[model samples]
Target: MHFLKAATIAILSPLVSATCTPWSTPGTCTATSSSCDFYTCLESKSGCGPTGYELGYALPFCNAITAVSSNLSVNGQAWYSATKLCLQNALSVEASCETSCTNIYLNAFASHVPCYLDSGFCELSGADLKVFFQVVGVAGVTSNDGLALFGAVLQGCVTKYQNGQVNMGWTKWLVRTLNGEI
Candidate 1:
């Protein structure tokens, strides 16, 4: 009886104690203590999270998005390649349909829209893209619903330029806001 009980407990313990790999989007780690915090590995140099555990989109580490967009407008054009792509995409979509699409959904009526064709220019040059990156990338930092806030800021800047409202220092402000530098 003792031997049988021991074996049963041993088998069940592993099952009962199984911990979750990574945390959810809001970044909740709801696993037993046995499970490790995926970020810990980054410090310890153990290994990057296995598949679907790197961070965004819940894809596997191997397949996850390793790079994020670094769109910045400095002198009449995008400073980063990704920013240029964003500009192209925005222009393409705008030409097809004058409506803007947030990376995440928000109140459309309240959201601002750029009236002019140079919305992306305003966003890149005005906002501090680097700051925006830090704010969004920081773990456990809930500045303003993360993605939603970012989308709103982006929308606002884009709308301003589109509406021909570009002015002194507006581009700088937009870049800082978008990058989380501010």
Candidate 2:
């Protein structure tokens, strides 16, 4: 029933879709688009962006990470949460990380991601997001291990995406799976 509801909703709802799409105007795109654009750029490795548009993740390798980490806090948060969920579903077979802390982390992220202005800049900092991910794995010393694993998994996903192994998100996969369409 839950799957049905989600699938129905997904099928009926409008969706955001883009890859290597151009957003020539700075502040004109939503954070979701900004993040997607960023991801597309990163995934391209050698080159990206449309013919006439400036690339979103054009900074040098290290600076691109810094820009995504510090400048686009919501994108960072989204990356963290999305990576976590992907790991929980794909690799953490016997272990699940969806505790209250996870909800809190996601909620904290939600508050920070929605206010994209025309400048492609968000006012939030990555420090808060860093702190949020640190506490999500588990409680006590176990949490330290969980946090480390979580970080590794997130980085691995990023690496795989950059290497052209995976998509940046799993919502569509979830929807297809739930509807027995995967």
Candidate 3:
């Protein structure tokens, strides 16, 4: 009887502890998995980038964001929507200009830092928060920690732009446009 119980436990252990790999393709993972956070699993195995910008990255990321946010409270949905828009716009700009536009893209996206911090994004916990940081490439940070990281990066961009270490005329225009000030 003892030997049988040990064998059964060993047989089931791997199934119970299995971790889902981050999604490489849509529909590969779903929220039903008890051990997987859907959003964390949406992080691209091939990475989101200027190279395969659309089909490979933006579409997958935005789709996952939309899917998850659809199930959240209204405030949470708004937060995710804003985040999606920011990335979409920034990535579009980067794709158009390649590496030359990287800083501008970063700064333009960073301009939304305040909004992300103040919005329902800060209210996220558990899986939602995990998803947020996973997309940010540093999975498992608290909302405060994530916002701090954004703030630090934004501050760095501001200092660099101020010191004339980087050019950002286009970024200024992009930020203005995004804010509806244009």
| Best model number under lDDT | 3
lDDT of 2 by residue, 88-134 (tens): 22211111212222222222222221221112112123464344434
- Per TM-score, the best of the predicted structures is 3
The lDDT per prediction is: 0.33, 0.33, 0.43
RMSD of 1: 20.9
Q: Which stretches of candidate 3 lie over 4 Å from their true place?
A: 1-60, 86-99, 125-127, 130-182
Q: CA lDDT of 104 in candidate 2?
A: 22
Superior candidate under TM-score, 1 versus 2: 1
lDDT tens string, model 3, 1-182?
A: 22233334435644764333433345432332122233233333323345343343335555666556655655556667666544434333232332322233233334344445444344444456555545546441335534554555445444544555545443344345656999
Name model 1 segments beyond 4 Å from true: 1-127, 138-144, 167-182
The per-prediction CA RMSD against the true structure, in angstroms, equals: 20.9, 18.8, 19.2
Q: Give the TM-score of candidate 1.
A: 0.22
Provide the global lDDT of candidate 2 against the true structure: 0.33
Candidate 2: segments with Cα more than 4 A from true spot: 1-72, 88-125, 137-144, 147-182
C-alpha positional error of residue 175 in candidate 2 after TM-score superposition, expressed in Å: 39
Measured against the true structure, the TM-scores of the candidates, in listed sequence, are 0.22, 0.20, 0.35
- lDDT order, best first, reads 3, 1, 2
List, residue by residue over 22-92, the lDDT tens digit for candidate 1.
Answer: 32223222221122232232212212234211222212211211233223234422333333233223222
